[model samples]
Target: MFCYQCEQTDRSDNLLLGCHSVKGNCGKDDRTATLQDVLIVICEAIGQYAVLLREKGVVDPTWAHRASYWVFTTLTNVNFNATVFQRMIADAIVLRDELKARYEAACTEAGETPVVPEGAAQFVPDPGMAGLLKQAPLVRVDANIDVLGADVVGVRNLNLYGLKGLCAYAHHAHALGHRTDETDAGIEKALAFLGDPPTDLDSLLGHALELGSLNLKVMEMLDAANTGVYGTPVPTQVRVTPVEGKAILVSGHDLGDLAAILEATKDTGITVWTHGEMLPAHGYPGLNKYEHLAGNYGSAWQNQHAEFAAFPGPIVMTSNCLIEPQPSYRSRIFTMGPVGWPGVRHLEHKDLGLLVKAAQALPGFATTDPERSITVGFGHDSVLANADAIVEAVKAGDISRFLVIGGCDGAKPGRNYYTEIAEKSGDDTILLTMGCNKFRINGHDYGTVAGLPRLLDIGQCNDSFTAVKIALALADAFDCGVNDLPLSMFVSWFEQKAAAVLLTLLALDIKNIRLGPTLPAFLTPAVVDVLVDKFALKPLGDPTEDLANAMAGA
Candidate 1:
């Protein structure tokens, strides 16, 4: 029951260096936690066959998407029901076994022997809860720590967690009807590497970097998937306040599901509001065209307990960042995709009519709240549209620098650093933000620069691609390397998705990035030393001091 895959992981400097208690920070019990590791073991096995079958060009992309989805369910704040995981275990085994059979046949046709993975890689879960619990110890995340030192374990887990986050993005892109063989094979290749479990730190760390490169392709597909459906994001101001009517709050980063919900509720009198990462949906022309798509309702995922409870209508979690649903609203709140809680109702295949019913039954927004708004939809295309102005502003020194200071936000201590950095930036600097980290200081006025808003909201965490594209365009416009541009990155990571983003930055050879509030609990001082030495990565210090140093080109 040990885990440290998210920012809110226990860091008491204990033996496990993670949540070894009955309940984790996201309210995941030990039973569910161990079962998640077991599921991952199955994924590694699937990947082992998937990689080979892919080479033979016989693997099904649906299975790869399934494997990626299984990884997404294991992410922090996603699924918490042990019973649901039990069924998933059985289904994953069927999937894994199907791949195993194909791999054997392919080898037979090629007249070559297929080497099968052993131990957890090919583990068969024993029947009943007792048998499952008994098998859990063999596949725990730290199972290799005793044989291979902590350093090797740390690097291996880094690669594993990076794959988890990268797969989540892949799942998102696939949901939007986007899939690529190259990325699918890469995901399987990563799983196959983890199946063998490397004992060397260098091999593990190097693979982590390769994962970063792979994530770029996944992000590009996701960017295409979104723009292809939504007709490219335009700068649109979204109301941050509530309006009068029956309401339904849709959270997470699934635009496809959100569109379905909108279609289902077109005339039901339920006004839909985007929450958490879904706030960026307003900027999309396709979504904005819906007359009942009201506005944003809450801040970030961490505040869901209070916000969801106080809300007037039923809530729908489209994908992730779900916490324990309170008794107050548990009955009305519904889980979609991989999100599940023991008692919370689950929506199947974006069948949002259930939410339409729940919202109509409840009182929604007693009256329209005061008007307030925030700007979003600064996708690469939107930003690049004003490329001429931005390049000229940079050359004229009107816009001194760009700061990317956002990632997944958490409920842990020290996150105020983001708020401080944003507020402390000089008028000459432009603030670019993504993920829930923007909720920390986005509501504050930072004023405009270079004939545009100083703080540009770049949609969700996946939109980190947009930020990178903007930087690259700037570099090309100025005829310099991306690293040579007057830019600085400060990443605030809470979960594995953020890990994938950080790895992408590192793969690009981008250096001098700062990370905090604390290093990942899974990483040892040895792993940190390697990052510090190679990438000039540093732990964040005083925000004001760091901002000043960044401005001075330090």
Candidate 2:
């Protein structure tokens, strides 16, 4: 098997002969590595097909969805089941053959050889392997690295992982009947770039930032799709109490799944409670009208191991941020769409029969007093509506600074830095947040200024588009560039969606954003330097110092 996705593999060593022991030392079976290679090649083919479709002005939604899903599925820890992998491979092969046929037919009609896009065939391995070696190779593993170390491998890993998350979000939007040619093309270009050999540290770093920039567009498209379908979110209060009786806890970022759950459980005596990033669904007018649509459970994803353990009802994850479940809640945890965890019930398609039955058999949810009431829904529309007031408040010195703090939360304890930063912000500051990451400090009563709550929860990570919109609106109202506005973006990234969003910001030349709790593991040193120099990107430092810097110029 020949593969070179990661830095650990020796480029000079093409043949795997007599290297079984060395492969074992790297903790990857030769068979698995070969499979990964094959999968990458298939992805390349799909990417090429997508490009052809775009050129023909007949983009296939199914092809885009499959391509994005495959990339997301290949991300670390996403799909470990060999059965699932094999199924995906089969599906991919079928899609590739169909696309190839379509391309050839189109070429025949035009009387020409199919002109595949450049770099599309890089991942395809030369066919000569034995029958046993037909599977794609597994990705080679890498050792951990310091969060700030300028390691090329680590940077690359981070870039790829971030792209995975972006692709997942893009796929979800596409699944919901939303399409963006720019977003799709951006992803295709980024993927092709990833397959390209790293020329130097600078080029890789620029690519990483580019990934962030593209992600921004992806986020915008998703935000538009959601808000257009569900209506602009308003600042509505969510209760924390579970309704005593049967209920379903809906988690993840898929509003489509949430809508189905709400519809499925209506009049069935089973309630729905939002969890993790789904908490903001309560603010949507369409979803809020459901009398039984209860409030949120747990603060964020990291606490799921403990929080989910105590959930006495069925739980459904519409997307990512799934933690390993405890035994007590393992049976209750049901995943739909792309989210999968071993031993948990996966609700395929829109079917919720199992969940409904499970809820019926269970004791149902509690109906106690809510822990506390917190307002959410301050999406782009709401923020834009209040743009004049916000600008006036800033001009009058009532609100000195606006801080965009959002992204993922992790098990790492250092993440408390976010909590501390949120708490320490001056009374004159307004905090805008999105994603599960905001739960770290969402509960803090940061107070209000000029009729606006200090802490604004702007939906899920994809809603980072909302945050961007607010920033751009503020810039417009202030009659200056986004960078000139009295705003600072202090983001925490965990997965690939964050990476895509970061790339979007970079693409727009948004600078001096602080990213942490840890940098990605795939970036090369030259790549990091490019980011630091070109975009003024910097890792998060002490909250006190960072906050001070954030407020100093404003």
Q: Give the candidate number with the greatest TM-score.
A: 1
Candidate 2, run of 10 with poorest lDDT: 136-145
Candidate 2, residues 487-525, lDDT tens digits: the string is 898888766677777777887788898988755534444
lDDT against the true structure, per candidate, is: 0.88, 0.72
lDDT of 1 by residue, 1-554 (tens): 77888877877766668887778877898889878988998998998888778777786788779999999999999999999999998899998888888888999999999876764466787868878778776777777688897788878888989999999999999999999988988998898888887688888888999999999999999999999988899889899888998999999989988998999999888899999999999999999999999899999999999999999998989888998888988888898888899988899755666678888899999888789999988888888999999889988999999999889888888999999998888898899899999899789889999888999998899888998899889889999998789999888988899999999999999988889878898888878999999988879999998988888766
lDDT of 1 at 2: 77
Candidate 1 regions off by >4 Å?
118-120
Which sections of candidate 2 miss by over 4 Å? Answer: 1-40, 53-58, 75-78, 115-159, 195-213
Error of 2 at 229 (Å): 1.7
